[model samples]
Target chain A: DQQVKQNSPSLSVQEGRISILNCDYTNSMFDYFLWYKKYPAEGPTFLISISSIKDKNEDGRFTVFLNKSAKHLSLHIVPSQPGDSAVYFCAALVSGNTPLVFGKGTRLSVIA
Target chain B: EAGVAQSPRYKIIEKRQSVAFWCNPISGHATLYWYQQILGQGPKLLIQFQNNGVVDDSQLPKDRFSAERLKGVDSTLKIQPAKLEDSAVYLCASSDGKDSFQETQYFGPGTRLLVL
Candidate 1:
């Protein structure tokens, strides 16, 4: 079963605009959420993360908002840049020493 | 600092053949993990080791897959008598095992395997 899901397969936005990526999860045990950005032939790099106790976390131009009641979360990038174009994977971390459960990923393209 | 290192970026083998992939995690990292990512799908954890000791292997297919981390460092993952369905990118990741909530995993480029 897919514990985490990213409904949108792809997204496109113009440079200097805002980009939003969404994710959902079915497992309530997950208390940590993370977003990773991946490029072709390279490993995924960490972007931003949020804990269940917080509704939102911000890092520079990236912000993650969590809505526990809806079992959903989103990553928002304001003034997106071409360098931001990549496949983004949303992952959920279960409490304790456990591996992350990842979603299918969403590909975002930022036009220059 | 050097990132995680993986050997033989790509490998091709026929079904029923054995294949082994190697990984060297970032220096001083106490936790190592192996994952399998199929095409068009997200990565799935295969096994995890904390300082040369297994922390989790519940998702590993022990019947055909085996992994080991020696001396609390570098690791190796092997698949014996592989099946066509075993084709996927094997990813190695590492993190400091100090705190679960603050830990951030760093991944390697991955080793892509193709089984005929």
Candidate 2:
């Protein structure tokens, strides 16, 4: 079963515009959520993360909002750049020692 | 600091053949993990190791897959009599393993395997 899901397969946004990516999970036990960005022929790179305790976390132009009641989360990139075009994977951690469960990923394309 | 290092960025082999992939985690990182990512899908954890000891291997297909981490530094994952379905990108990741609350995993470029 897919514990995590990203409904959108792909997205396109104009450069300098806001880009929003969404994710959902079926497991309520997950306490931490993370977002990773990946380029072609490379591994995923960490982007932003949010703890269950907090509803939102922000790092520079990136912000992650978590809604516990909905078991959903989202990543927002403001003023998106061309470099921001990549596959974004949403991952969750149930506990400190457990492995991360990842979503199918959303491919974002930024056009200038 | 350098990120995780994986060998043989790409490998192609036929069915029933054996192949091995290696990884070198970042300096002083105690926790290591291996993942398999199929096309159009997210990565799935195959195994996790904490300082040369296994922490989790529930997702690993032990019948054809095996992994080992020596001296808590480097690790190797091997597949014997590989099948066509085994084709995927093998990713290696590492974390500090000290603080779970703030733990961040670093991943390598990954080794892509194609079984014909």
Candidate 3:
């Protein structure tokens, strides 16, 4: 019963290219979505997030787009760098207090 | 400015053994969470604490898993009579105790457990 799902298990992109990671959710109760990037030995680090009321949020090189009607969200990293190679997990929750439901994660590999 | 802290970065234990993992959230953050990340899978929430009180622990395996936050700052998760499937990276995360939708959770390096 995975409420959040990342359909792609892996993605490969060239350096300086744009990398897009997609995630879908079945639960409409989830109003907040988050993207976390994780390196090989470290815990998942918060990258970006969006709320149900908004359609897009961007910070630096990362941008997140949310479509409530589609129950979908995506993270776009422009000009991908080698350092961006890592497993990215998408999570969703109704609010801050509730535990987040996470996707299995998509491993992104940026070839240099 | 320090991130969440976890100790004993790596541990190897046998089946039926007992193991404990500790976590220290960031200063002034009142929310703490413990998650289990198996290989090729995302982190699964085991428990969450807000100011020493449990917010959620529904997914916890109560029979073998127990956790406590004595002072509301640091927490410990223990698994008694562990099973091989219990081997995974235990992650501790924290966030500011706010009721907003923009809160971001900070994570620790994580403690990797290998049950043999």
The global C-alpha lDDT for each of the candidates, from Candidate 1 onward, is 0.94, 0.95, 0.94
**Which structure is stronger by lDDT: 2 or 3?**
2
Each model: TM-score of chain B? 0.97, 0.98, 0.97
Model 3 CA lDDT for position B9? 98
Between which residue pairs do clashes occur in model 2?
A: none
User: What TM-score goes with each of the models?
Assistant: 0.97, 0.98, 0.98
lDDT of 2 by residue, A1-112 (tens): 9999999999999999999999999999999889999999999999988889999999999999999999999999998999999999999997676899999999999999
- lDDT tens per residue, model 1, A3-106: 99999999999999999999999999999999999998888898999989999999999999999999999999998999999999999997675899999999
Which candidate achieves the best TM-score against the true structure?
2
Measured with C-alpha atoms, the lDDT of residue A16 in candidate 3 is 99
Question: Looking at model 3 chain A, which ten-residue stretch has the lowest summed lDDT?
Answer: A92-101
State in Å the error of residue B89, model 1. 0.7
Candidate 2: stretches off by over 4 Å:
none
Order of the predicted models by TM-score, top scorer first: 2, 3, 1
Candidate 3 stretches greater than 4 Å from native: B100-102
Error of 3 at B82 (Å): 0.7
DockQ of 3: 0.73
- Model 2 scores what on Cα lDDT? 0.95
* Better model by DockQ: candidate 1 vs candidate 2: 2
